[model samples]
Target: MGGKHSVLGNSTLNQSPTIENIQAAYKEGDTSRAQELIKISCGENNRLRLEKHQLLSVAAGNGDLEAVQYLLKEGRVDLPREPTDENPAVVAAYYGHEDVVKELLDSLPGTNWIGLRRLQELDVSDNRLTEVPACFLHCFKSLRSFNVSRNKLKVFPDPWACPLVASLIEFPGFLSECLEVLFLNDNQLEAVPQSVCCLKSLNELYLSHNPGIRELPPELGQLSNLWQLDIEELNIGNIPAEVRKEGPSAVLAFLRAHLRKAEKCKLLKMIIVGPPRQGKSALLEALQTGKVPQMMQNETSIRTTKWELEKPSGVKDKMDSVEFNVWVIGGPASMSTVNQCFFTDKALYVVIWNLALGEEAVANLQSWLLNIEARAPNAAVVVVGTHLDLIDSKFRTERIATLRAYVLSVCRSPSGTRATGYPDITCKHLHEVSCKTLEGFDGLRRLLFQVSCNIKDMSNAATSQKLVGRLIPKSYLLLQAAVLAERLRRDLEDEVQYLTDLQLEQIIEQNPDSDIKDYEDLQTD
Candidate 1:
């Protein structure tokens, strides 16, 4: 027992920190030496000082504001040293140590300290900030990037109205003309001040998720240097023909409405055939027009449309047909249900859409040919590559050549035409269309015209056998249903309005009327 060595005996063998002197004083319950040791070790380069950095930071982490103050004041610890082991400011702010944070700010030298700027990047998300603090103006002036997304700020901070005027007095020219990004997403800002447009150096501004914003200022176009502007969730209701004349807010509103109605509509005819999300719908809209909104996307598994535009066949004939029923068969890849609604004598005009634009385009062409020949022999078969614009120009050229070859191989030549008394198939093909540029649209229109014309000439008797397979003879059923539903809605609204009008009239009638006295009485008086 006497020969046994204690763990403390080997403490000096390795340069491990024992804190023996401090411990001995602590164990003895003597406060004097412990205090003296703390002063000395925290003073400058005491041997154990660097080793105890984690412990010192832990003290700061535990909200020992006094210890933090001591460490910072002793000049042993770097106050703003690239914040490792969980940044003190971040932790303090996260834990709601407002006083400690305030103390740190007060202790920081005027020249070296960046006060509210530290709060910019720290995650205080979901915090409800009604107004921006005055000090933050100083921060914003000096700030290059700020993310206040997902906060509940109802109005633009008052400081933004003047661009750091008050802050500049304290630290002259602290906020030099250099700011780049500002995120005000998920807030309740109805209108942004024109002062924001003055930030010439700014490039990206995210103002998404503010639903109450009804308009954008006309001056927004002045920010010519801006690269990315995110207004995804703002309630912009319409698009205007001219951005400058109508104002930026009106323009954005117009764009939003366009995106909502046009981007995801059945008219876009976007059959997404890629791996997933290669901006197929976006591309379609860009081609259809020039700008697309974020809300235009297919969000459901099954979406069926009964609109005039859903079926292109109806649109062309709308001008001519006094009473006609037209519908088209198309949708997502998940639509496995045969388009029985449109096909009676078999497919009249089959649109073979090859979405992949891959080597399999040839195979797809061949398969479609077989389908057209077997299912609807007389129907005009049109094979289309939907995302042809996405393909590289070089690869697209090669694929076009390959696809044409395959199509010609599968198709039979006209019955009367012959190659040395042998029959051969004649094929027509087209390529390289964009939803963004409106290119190849004319070709598509012409193709549809040819197919529709061919189908119109088919004899009723020849198509009767195929039609009988699923003939309910209900051409007006859908129209009748829609009309009935719309009529009922209108009738209910009219009845309600009529009743409201009668009540308003009764109230107006009940009001007391005063007798007129007259100019004659004044003359007599």
Candidate 2:
């Protein structure tokens, strides 16, 4: 036997051991040697030179389970009060030793274990953890801050596996009651689970940098306490552009607005019909950009001109705004035959008549309305009297009254035998507009918005009837052949090129088929 050595100085003798020898023994997995050294260090009346926390941390970090247990049980060493730079559990996790990590967590006091506990924050980030350990729920009921970022997690922690959450669902507060901050960024999560909504106290959530997550559950809106939500670098198209430009408040507003019935807001088709040179195109321009066209042309339009107004003003109370497809039919009464083709039960008819021609306004309005009713019965009509600036102040009142009375009488009258062709017509609104002065345009715009919002689900019967009525048997056969040719081009696997309009016309001329000649006039260059 050798003489005893001082606890503070290096061990020169064989009887006393130093902290370096204990660390070396632990790293070598020599539990017996480590235990023998610990016993000599804690010998009766012996001054303690090394801390137990330091010895246990080295044992746990080396993945020596037996050494860790021997030091904790026989050495009478307490668990680390708080995590430090050399935290044993963090080091074990960093080494990918699942058993050592579990053992370190298992040594912590249970929920009922009485003491001055201080284990609240756990940072197992930058590890090879595929999933969070379920034992965390049982051992660390007081855990408030957790960071599992930069891991291989495909989904969130399953709450069903947690015994505390299963047993406390009926209570006001459940598992993770004290959890305030959670970082699950840079993982392979596809969708957020609804269970995260249970974390009522979670204040800040970091879910950005995940490309697989395409859609967020609508239930995320239930997290009322969440203020800082980071969803950057995702492919979520449902979110409006405003959210990315303005921030989280816009996202909240968008979510709240979409929580309604699907049929409440829909696109509306509006047909603007009347005699030519009644400012129909000018009215559309004013409604679109609020700027009237400087030069007015009186030329008849050969084809229908289309304008679309998305999210127009005057109707914002609904969950989503309505889109108006305004089709203005131009040309004289001869062109009105094409108007029947576009008629639909859900359409709103805006009849524009020149108010400058006082008495003639009655005849003009009646002709357009009757033409529209013949095709689209049951259609909602808005009678707009344009060119009011040209009317004299002396006869303005009389002219307006006469026009209103005549239009109402025609709309109210029964079609009799002709009624079988279309639905009953009704005038929903009557207003005078001035394209040059922009006097009554505001009221007309508001009326169009209100009427379009109410109309819904118009039938397609009128469209089918018009198509069938216009084409003969020979002409119809050519149309079907053209349609089949178009479909073939679309469905063909080969990158086959089709002939242009001029080419097709040239081919038809060289062949000279009677059926093709019947539809030749209908073809456009």
User: TM-score, each model?
Assistant: 0.32, 0.43
lDDT of each: 0.44, 0.60
RMSD of every prediction: 24.2, 19.2
Compose the digit string of candidate 2's lDDT tens values, residues 101-200.
Answer: 6777667775332221345666767666677654343445566776777777775455422233323432214343776887878887776544565677
lDDT for 388 (candidate 2) = 87
Give me candidate 2's TM-score against the actual structure. 0.43
Poorest 10 consecutive residues of model 2 by lDDT? 462-471
Please name the candidate that would achieve the greatest lDDT relative to the true structure. Answer: 2
